[model samples]
Target: MPQANWFPRFRLFLLGVLCVVPSSSLFAQEQPGQFVLTPGVVVDRSANRIFVVEPSDALATVALQSNTGEVLWKNESATRPLSISAGHSLMSLGSVDANRLGVLVLDGDTGKVRAESPLNIPPEAATLAAPLGEGRLDATAVIRGQRGLLRWNYTPPVTKQGLPPGTLSGLPNAELIPEVAQPQPALNDNPGGFVEIDLETGEQSVVDPAAAPNFAPANDAPEQPLLPEIPGPKYLSADGRHVMARERTKGESHRFMMLVFDKQSGEAIGKFPSNVSYVPFYVDEGRIVLQKEEFAEAIDGQLVKQPRQLQALDLNSGEVIWRQPIAEMKFRGPPPP
Candidate 1:
């Protein structure tokens, strides 16, 4: 179970930034200052609201206020959420002006910025994004009109070969993200293909990554919003009725304590400590939303995690109804979420 290319793209020492682990490697008994997981909670429960993106280098989102979660709107410019079609709710990667390259489609549900639409791709290619610090992981199946692909994952710029940017890429993206080779000059400015968007007139095209398309039968239809790079121990709300699960109250412990299950009666409604980045919202049958990250302590000896809060629970008194608080995100890129 240890083969996401052997996972070790370490980051999160509370931004003290330090990762060693080289006893000869093989995970060297794990712990390269671990703790780097951000998608940071996203539970829109058909407008019950509670999104807290917080990528801390750029992403800083927060749109609470649905049943008094308070604080509706901070900054929005979503980073690849694609698949809330027709009414298109989150699809990032914008700009159909300033030089072509598009994809903005944001509705963000009355938190402001209603509709963006832009992603025409083609301004000399090469510049997919998410490289030069970190914060990226996209996978789409978008459908409303016709063709839809979107695979964009940058991650390549080992400081111009000085290493220290997740360092150990063979990129198959975990085999597909595990093809590590090109580290000699940004390799065509860091690219990875398949951005076929046309989910109805937004139009754009580009494919190579070996022709990529099959979209797993349209991202396993359950009413497609197609987003899976790793989204859940089981979440599904936004009108699918209810289905949250992100368990780990202690099992792979590294200072973990996170729960949110009700995967159809497994119980354990909500209890956030943090670690869940996309979808975990039920709101309505009584409430439940998740996203919080705070490991705080152990700096040099290692155990650094950060991403303050954004909580909501009460699926029948699970308690912790409102928490919101996440600050410290740089690299600038705010305008849609």
Candidate 2:
């Protein structure tokens, strides 16, 4: 009977090996360089790359890398200069006299410029914000306007919309896009394709600004004054659902809050304290991973601080789930004890 059971065990083991062999082969066959930008910037995987508008007001630089941390490509323009939002797309003011910002779209995979549109805005615009949706080239531009916000749909010939007031601040022209009105999400991976909670329809679609675009001379709503007690907004959620901010307390240390908001309506959902400073936080699924800093006592008078723990927060429940510690082995040994 034992010998008979051995044969059955051998058959089961052989079957397991056969299944493992294919998976191992597939894993070995796949190129390790296929994945790009590990962990990715912005919670939005779509905006895997990042570009910085240089402080010198000169040219902009793209930060492109494979998922394996390999530098894929970079673009630097000295003539026109560039200001990219968050992803492959960039904004370039053609000239000081030009009254518009040229929205330049680029392929995320290949870093190729595909299209350009002149966003109707004054050259003196302070900053440019980018969102991801659709393809690498096809994206929405959320232009920071003097009065309000201007949204431009780059693919469909730069459809313009303006948000006066009471709409979302940064994403002013979001309402002009029809996809934002729909129940399902419209803008996918394009520059500005994120759905917000549409309060009127009670559905998720593209995020709307504080006020809808006043295309005609209609009775624009009164501008709402800034709230006195409202805490200052410090961070914008990549998906446009929440804002991580800090409020100064009378005598206490700085109060940190993870402000959950309705992306569509720009209404406050809830705010929870994270109780940390200058820490990098990420919204994974619905949880917030606050990468906290840890310090080791200055023993040999060297400036080497070690990271200690990752504070994880449950955004929905507003609770600290766990504090994952950084393994001591990850850090080099100090000069002495």
lDDT of 1 by residue, 1-337 (tens): 2212112121121121111111111112122211111223334444555444444644334556657777666554453233333242544443234333345554556534343445432222223222223323233333333444555443332322344665556544454444434444434454445666654455566677665634332121133232333245454553343454344556643433444444445555544444433433444556654444453545678876644665567766566766666543222232232
TM-score of 2: 0.28
Clashes of each: 31, 24
- Any idea what lDDT model 1 has? 0.41
Say which candidate scores most in lDDT.
1
The parts of candidate 1 lying over 4 Å away from their true place are 1-3, 6-46, 53-65, 70-83, 86-155, 158-189, 197-322, 326-337
Residue-level error in angstroms, candidate 2, position 233: 11
